[model samples]
Structures are given as C-alpha cells and as structure tokens.
Target: MAKIMLVDDAAFMRMMLKKALTESGYTDFVEAQDGAEAVKKYGEENPDLVIMDITMPNMDGLQALKKIRESDPDAKVVMCTAMGQEAMVVEAIKSGAKDFVVKPFNGERIVQTVSSILGK
Candidate 1:
C-alpha cells in the first residue's frame, strides 16, 4: 500500500479524494488543509505521494511542491486543479510534479494517475 498525502483547503475535497483513494485500494493517507500544513506534514509523514491542490492559503501547491522537491529531489507529487488553471498546471509540471488531476474529482482517473505514477 502506498502512503499518500491529500492536500486541499476544502474539507469536502479532501474527503472526496480520500474516499476515492480508499475505494481504489489506497488506504494509507495523510491529509492537510492547506499548503503550509501540507509542507509540514510532508516532513513529518514522508508519504509516498502527495495529491496537492493548486490554489490554497498560506503557500499554494506550487510553492509547496518546490519546497518538497528541494528537500527530497525524488518526491512524487500530483497536482490537483479545478478547471481553468492550465497555466498553474503547466508551472507545477515544470516545478517537478509527477502528474495532475482535474476537479471536480474523477475517481477512476485519480486512481489511474496515482497507479501510473507509483508504477502499480
């Protein structure tokens, strides 16, 4: 099982992702409400993968992704973006995110992306 981190300001989004991941056989999870918390939890938990939201308070996903990458060059992150954030997604890819998933949440796509990234 992979230890995954789900980072989003919205509790609903986190819950949705968690549910989807759990249903997909990914049970181990660490959740953060925002980028600052995500960064802190990343260090404490060292999860295998991070599913991060692009827009968040106190840092945002891109900045957290950069910080995580700086600390662990091999850190695997998959950015989550709502529709219309193409530019941010591109920037995230440039900054070292392993992949991306768009919202409003497609459970299968999220699982597929995660499985692909983890080579499962």
Candidate 2:
C-alpha cells in the first residue's frame, strides 16, 4: 500500500479522508494539520502521495505545493478545495498539483483519483 499524507486544518476532514482511504484498503497514512506542517512532514515522511487542502492557516496549499515541488519536482500532490475555488485550483495545477478534488466529494471519486495518479 502507498503511504498517503492527508493535509487539512480540520481534524474532522483529515479523519474523513483517512476513513475513506482506509475503507479502500489503504493502511498507511501520515497526517498534518496545516500546509506548514504538511511541508515539514513531507520532508520527513516522504509519503507516496499527498492529498492537501487548498486553504489553511500558516501556509496555504498553493504555497506549500510550490515549496514541496521546488524541493522535490516529482512530488505527487492532489489539492482539495471547496466549491467556487476554481481559480485556486487553476493556480494549483500550474504549480504542479497532480489533480484537484472539490469539497463535499465522495469516497469513490477520491479513491479513483488517488488510484489513477498512483497508477495502482
């Protein structure tokens, strides 16, 4: 199983994502509460992929995404954004986000996206 990192300010959101991924048979996970933590953990954890929220205190996802990509060009990142955040999504893609998932997302969609990106 791939080691996945879930990055979000909300503990509930991280729990939900972990639950969804766990149900799909993904057992390995690393969690970060904000983009800053995410960036720091990325270096330490080197997760196979990162599912990150677009907005967070300390450092936003877009900025963190850039920093991670700057350090590791092959970093695999998928941005999670609330609806009406298409502009940030665009910026994320430009900044090397592998994909974007809208909030209120279903487990299936996220699972599929992760599978596809990880080439599982």
Candidate 3:
C-alpha cells in the first residue's frame, strides 16, 4: 500500500481525488490545504507520493517542492497545474517534481500518474 499525499487549497478537489484513488484501490492518504502545510506534513507523513496543486496560498507548490526535495532527494512529487502554466511546470520539473497534472482534475489521468509513479 503506497502512502500518498494530496495537497490542494480546495477541499472538494482533495476529496474528489481521494475518492477516485480509493476507488482505484489506493488506501493510504495524507492531505494538506496549502504549500505551507504540505511542507510541514511531508516530514511527518513521509508519503510515497504527493499530488500537489501549483497555485496555493502561503508558499505555492514549486517552493514546497524544492523544500521537500531538499530534505528528501528521493521524494516523489507530482504537480497539479492549470492550463497555461507550462512555464511553471517546466520549473517544477527542473526542481525535481516527478510529473504533473492539469486542474479540473481528471480521475483517470490522476490515477494513471499515481500508478506510474508508485509502480502500483
């Protein structure tokens, strides 16, 4: 069972993601509402994978990604970005994010990304 972290400002998005992943047979989950919380929780939960939104209050995904990767070089983070954020996605990739997903969350894409990353 891979431990996964879901980080997004919107509670609905997190819930949706959790629901989708659970239905797909993923059980373990940790959630945070913003990048700041995510950074703090990363150390505590040490999840196998993270699905994080790019635009968030108090630190943003790119910053959090850097900090997490700094602490754990092997950390696997998948960024969630909106359309037209290709520049940030490039930066995210350069900063060590394992992959990315676009917002308005697609259940199938999210599941596929998670499965590929965790090899589940």
Better of 2 and 3 by TM-score: 2
Candidate 2: stretches off by over 4 Å: none
Clash totals for all candidate models: 0, 0, 0
Q: For candidate 1, write residues 1-120 as lDDT tens digits.
A: 999999999999999999988998999999999888988999999999999999999999999999999989999999999999999999999999999988997999998999999999
TM-score of 2: 0.98
**10 in model 1: Cα distance from truth in Å?**
0.4
Q: Summarize candidate 2's per-residue lDDT along 1-120 as a digit string, tens digits.
A: 899999999999999999998999999999999889999999999999999998999999999999999989999999999999999999999999999999988999999999999998
> What's the lDDT for residue 59 in model 1?
93
The lDDT-based order of candidates, best leading, equals: 2, 3, 1
Candidate 3: RMSD to truth: 0.7
Please provide TM-scores, in order, for all candidate models, with all chains considered together.
0.97, 0.98, 0.97
For residues 12-40, write the lDDT of model 3, one tens digit per residue.
99999999999999999999999999999
Show model 3 residue runs off by greater than 4 Å. none
Worst 10 residues of 3 by lDDT: 101-110
